[model samples]
Structure formats: C-alpha cells, structure tokens
Target: MAETNDILEVAKMTISTSIKCNTVRGFIGWHSCDNICMDMHDVLDMCEDAFKRERYQESLEADTYVLVSGVKLASCADSSSGMLTDVIMRAFELIDLSTQTIAKLDAAMRKHALSLIIKEAKKKAFDGWDSWRYELLEKAVCLCDEKLAAKLEKLLDIFLEDIENDYMPEYKRQEDTILRYKLHRHLKGADAVKDELYANLYIREMCIIAVKDATDARNYNEAEKLCLEQIKKEDGRFYRNTPEDWNNILFDVYMQSGITDKQIEQAKKILLLGNEGFWDVLKRLYQSQGIWESQKPILLKELKQCKYSVCYRSVLVKENEKKLLLEAVTENPYNLFYYAQFLVMDYPNEIYELCANYIREQCAQATDRRLYKKVCKDLLQLIKWKGNATAKLLVDEFKATYPRRSALLDELQKVEKKL
Candidate 1:
C-alpha cells in the first residue's frame, strides 16, 4: 500500500509537463491508480502501457475516455487537439477492438467511480447496442472517412470467418456473438416489418432464438409453442440440410427439457421428419410408440426405406425385423451400412461374412473411386467400432485386390493403428 501511494505521489507531481510521459512509462511495469494523467498524449500513452501490462481495467478507463473525448473535443471549442482521433485509432489497432476488453470496461463502470468522459463512452458504446460490432463500425467511421468505414465493414463481414493465425479464442467468440446480436435485433425490427419474403427469412431464425431463449429459461410451453408454430408454418416442407433434418432442433429441445409424454405426438411428428434416418430421435420415437404387435408391415417398409435407420436397432435383434433386415441387405447391398449397425448388435460373425462378401464383390469390380472411397470409409468405421474379424477380412481382401494401388494401400496403412 505504501509503495503504490508513493508511486501515485510521484505520478501526481509529473501530471502536466512532458515528464508526465515518464509517469505513463512508469505505469507500463507497475500498478495503475486514479488520476494518472489528464493530458491527451499522456492518457493515450498510459492506456497503451496499461494494456501492455494486461491491466485492462485501467487501460479501458483511459482508452475509452480518449476515444469518446476525441469525438466530442474535435467538434467542440477544443478542436485544437483534433489529433486525439488518431490516438484513438492507434489504441483500437492495439486492442483489436476486443469484445472481452469492452466487457471488462462495462463491468468496471458498474463498480468504480468512473470519469464523466468514460461514463459517456460506456453509454455510447453499449447502452442501446446488443454487442460491439456497430460500436467498432462507429469507431472506424470516426477515425477515417464515412465511405472508407463502410467499405471496411463490408470487407470485414465477408472475411470475419476467414481471418486466421490469431491465438485468442475470445476474439472469435466476440465476433460470432456480435453477429448473432446484430441478427436478433435486425430480425426484431425492420425485418419483422418487411415484405413477405424478407419477413419469412427471419421465421426460422426467430423460431430458433425463441426456442433457445425459452429453453434457457425453462419455459417449456413457450419453447414447444414456438417449435410447433415452425412446424405448422413449414407444413411438411421441412427442408433438411446436409446431415440434419430441419426439425432436429425441435426434437432436441424437447428431449433436453426432460419433459415426457406417453402420447408422443411430438415424437411421432419427429419420426415423420426422416432423412436416411441415422439419428437418435427416431429411437426415442419408437420407444414412445410402444411397437405394437400390429405395426409389422409398416415396420418392414420403413426398415427397407430408411436403410440407415436406427429407430428400431435395439429391438431388431429380438423382433421380426431381423429377417427383413437380412432380406433388405440381400436386395440392396448398400443396405449393409445400416444392416451392419443392427447386425453387429447380435450377429457380429454373420455380419463379418456379409462384410467379407461385399469386399469381395467390390474388389472384383472395375475401379469406381467414389464408391471405393465410401466403402473404405465404412470399413474403417466398422473396424474402429471393434468389428475385428470383419475389418481384418475386408482389409485382407483390399490388399489382395488392390495390391498395385500403392497410394491407396499407404493411406489405408496410415489408419492401421485404428485396426
């Protein structure tokens, strides 16, 4: 305490003249205190120095004061220090306008007796905005010309994800969170007022956010209602993206909420939202539906259609579905992907024979690299999942069949440890 007080005393003595520069320099390696420097250059230098020492709370105090002060000062009676704008831009570059830094500033403002300039800076940067993207844009506009700022914003948006080599993960989170905040506000305002196409564009996004917010708050009814509204609006047109059905979110929300219903109207609706059907929701749906003694034909057709379905995988071993699975595998050889999953649960040895036969057939054929690659990937997964004999037979067959394809063998060899 004495050391800090003594340091503050010396810094207070050097506040005005160029030697105040030394006070700013002194803060680079030690503690920062109140009223370090009132001069613009010294304040800027102190902010940078505090930043160098990772003393963010003090740096933000000095930095935000300088940024907002520059804008207000340049337009007011003290336009003599217009170079304050340049100082602000340099500080921005140093911090990369980090959101984590802004968050610290916000947290500090609530706890400490901040300067009036810093208070105004906090309001201007955060009061109305959900995140810091626009504040950064505003800074860019103030530092440079308006047109250049707009162009810079466009380029940054296009390449926000393309940026690389920065080791700080929080910066990326800030960028993503800012985009989400901007999107939420835009959809709530002008987007909700726009024409049909524009309005419809926000439907999925709004529904997603509504469900997420409701789920977070444990408002199960609200989440379910929003999900139902989405399903109703789409009305069987739920477009599946790559590897996911659009209704997957609704299913996931309900499952995660720990709410159960025996009727499973939602579960049945989810089962109807199928895409190759390798997901867990189908299993939950089937379990809820209580596999009737009468649903046999429906089950068979579903098994054949949803060739990669996992909905009935656990029951397939004991149920009548095993014969149908074998038949489906015989009729459509590629059904082995799904069949192997079920068959491995009970008939690992039989599946091993099936895998061997498929490998033999694939090896005998002329090279179809795309098909070969897919088959190889499936074999690698089968081996990875402890399909020992099946993997061994498939690999031995691959070696016998594609011996001359050294490049392919070498690639397979790289994954041999997974064997």
Candidate 2:
C-alpha cells in the first residue's frame, strides 16, 4: 500500500508537468502540432475538467497553475501581456464556481488568483480603453467574498489613480471621465448617470458615447445638437482635419427621421467631403422633392468648387456631362486612358490624339521596366477601345524615340504582339 501510494504521487506530478508543457506549447503555437487557440483550450480544459468532477480546489489549482505558467511563458516569449491576461481570465471563468461555492473556497487562494489576473491586465499600456479589463475585474468582484470584493474594488480605484498621472493631462482627464462614467453607469444604471459635454478633450470618444446615449433615448434634437456642437468644437482646432464623424451621426439621424431637407443637407455635406455614396442619396432626396432640375446645377457648382471632390468626377460621369468630363480629362491627362472610354464614342479622333500625345510623354520620361509596362498597358487599352491604328502608331513612335532603351523595347514588343 505504501509503494502504491508513492507511485500515485509520482503519476500526479508527471501529469501536472505534462499539462504545463502542453499549456505553454498551445498558448504560443510553439510546437508544430500546437496552435495558440488549441493550447489555450488545453489550459481551460484542465480547470473545466476538474470543476466538472466536483473537485473545486483542484479546479482553482488549475487556474492558478495556468495563470502563473502563462505569466512566466509571456516573459520568455514575445507574446503580449494582454494576451496572458485574457488567458488567465478565461481560466478563472472556466472554474465555474458559483457565488455559493466561491463563499466556501479558501479566501486567500481566491484573492491571489483574482489579483494575479488583474495585475497582469494592468501590465498592458493604458490606452484610455482599459474599461474592458476593469469589466473583468468587476466580474471578479462579484465572484469574491465581500472583504475580497472591497479589496479588488480598491485595487481598481488605485489602477485608475495610476493612469490619471499619465504625462498627457488632457488624455488622462478625458479617459478618467469616460471610465468613471462607465463605472457609474454599471453601478447606478445608465439612466442615473447624467450626460456630460466633452468639448475640450482632443479625444472625442467621450463625446461619441454621449451622442450615442442621447440617440438611444430617442432624443433626436439632443443627438443632433451634440453632433453639431462637436463639429463646431472640432472646427476651432486647426491641428486636426474636419471629423466626418459628426456628419455621419447627423446622416444616420436624418435617414432614421426620413427628414428629406435634413437628408439633402447632410448628404451634400458628406459628398463635398468626397464621400460619393451620398451622391445618390442627395439626388434621390432632391428628386423626391420634385426640385432635382433646379438643384442639379447648384450641386454641380459646389462639387466643382471643392477642388479635390471625388463626387465631382462621379457626378459628371453619371450626369453624362460629356463636355465637363472631357475638360477634366484634358486638365489631368494622367486620367486620360481611364476617361477615354467615356469620351471615346463622342470624340474618337480626339481620344486617339490624346492617347498618342500621352504615350509620347510617358515614353520620353519612363526609364524603368515598370513604367514601360504601364505605358504598354495603356496602349493595350487604346486597342481595346478600337484605337488599333493609334496603338500601332504609338508603338512605332516609342521604338524610334527610345531606340537605345532595351527595357522599353522589351515592354513595347509585348504591346506590339498584342496590337
């Protein structure tokens, strides 16, 4: 009996060692057969399997082993501490201890396990989004006895205090506001928390949260005011580009409200910012109001004035404004081949002449095989557009102009074969 007992003890130690080895291998895909996900499951399986067998202490032991092993593994590998925190959290949850079971467990063991996970979570750099880790910590609080829960809550407060001293005071202030707001909502209910304006913070995440809260409450006017005020605040800051997010929020509101005038106004603002999806929305809004004809030229003039407007080109094409489209191509010959198909039927001879001139300029400047291939690609496009005669003539012109250029000749030969 003594020898049997000794053998069983050795077997237990061997199994524990094997499990640890597998956990490390699986967590990081260290071995050829192991993957990160599979290894993580292996770690969780030990806790879950022990929990299922009513071995609560062993389940907790599994949690401790995996957390401690994972932390040690993380230090040795290039793996993120955040990932280790996540693994430990999963292991703790898999223990499947209820509030009743948690009350009966060894208090010191539970506190140590919970503290390890939270401490590892804090190892990650605070990015103003540590709310997720706190959320896990909150769950830990519920699982702990009252005394431990208080300790964990105080730890959370300390964590917040540590981040408050981050060098960037503005970010620290805004992040603290958002986190405390979230915590208050979690504790006192969202409705109990009053919405605060965050006009001064460079990071607009808090403002976004406020707008979402107002929108959720069906307060469209409040939501609209928040968006507009945020946009106004943003406009005063010269360092950042105008945030399209405010317009996007108003766009959603206008769409939901079916307010055509507001939709048209929002759509135009988005389109002027080069978001082309709003072009169709704006058109439909104007057409629904039976004022498309009167509004068309006004929109076109606005698009033309917004020098870099993507909607301008799209509008000209869809509106079939051939004259204006041709002028655009003429102004930027780099768009010559792309716009050629649109203008080809109306001005075939002009398209051919433009193709020949563009090819001449490309050949004159192109020094590498890549640029030569690009020029040849355009030449092939001309052929596809029934500019066969022009394609052949340009190939001859490039060969003569770049006679000593072997790479250009090589690419032009490919085009000649296609021609």
The number of the candidate with the highest TM-score is 2
Please, what are the lDDT tens digits per residue for candidate 2 over residues 327-346? 77777775677778889999
**What overall lDDT, based on C-alpha atoms, would model 2 receive against the true structure?**
0.65
Prediction 2 TM-score vs. true: 0.65
Give lDDT for model 1.
0.50
Off by over 4 Å in 1: 1-54, 57-203, 212-225, 232-246, 252-259, 271-324, 335-364, 367-419
Instruction: Give lDDT: candidate 2, residue 110.
Output: 65
lDDT of 2 at 237: 32
TM-score against native, each model: 0.36, 0.65
Candidate 1 lDDT, 104-160, residue by residue in tens: 344343233222222343353432221333344333222223333344445446435
Can you list the residue pairs that collide in candidate 2? 26-39
lDDT of model 2, residue 361: 87
Backbone clashes in model 1, listed as residue pairs: none
Query: What does candidate 1 score on TM?
Result: 0.36
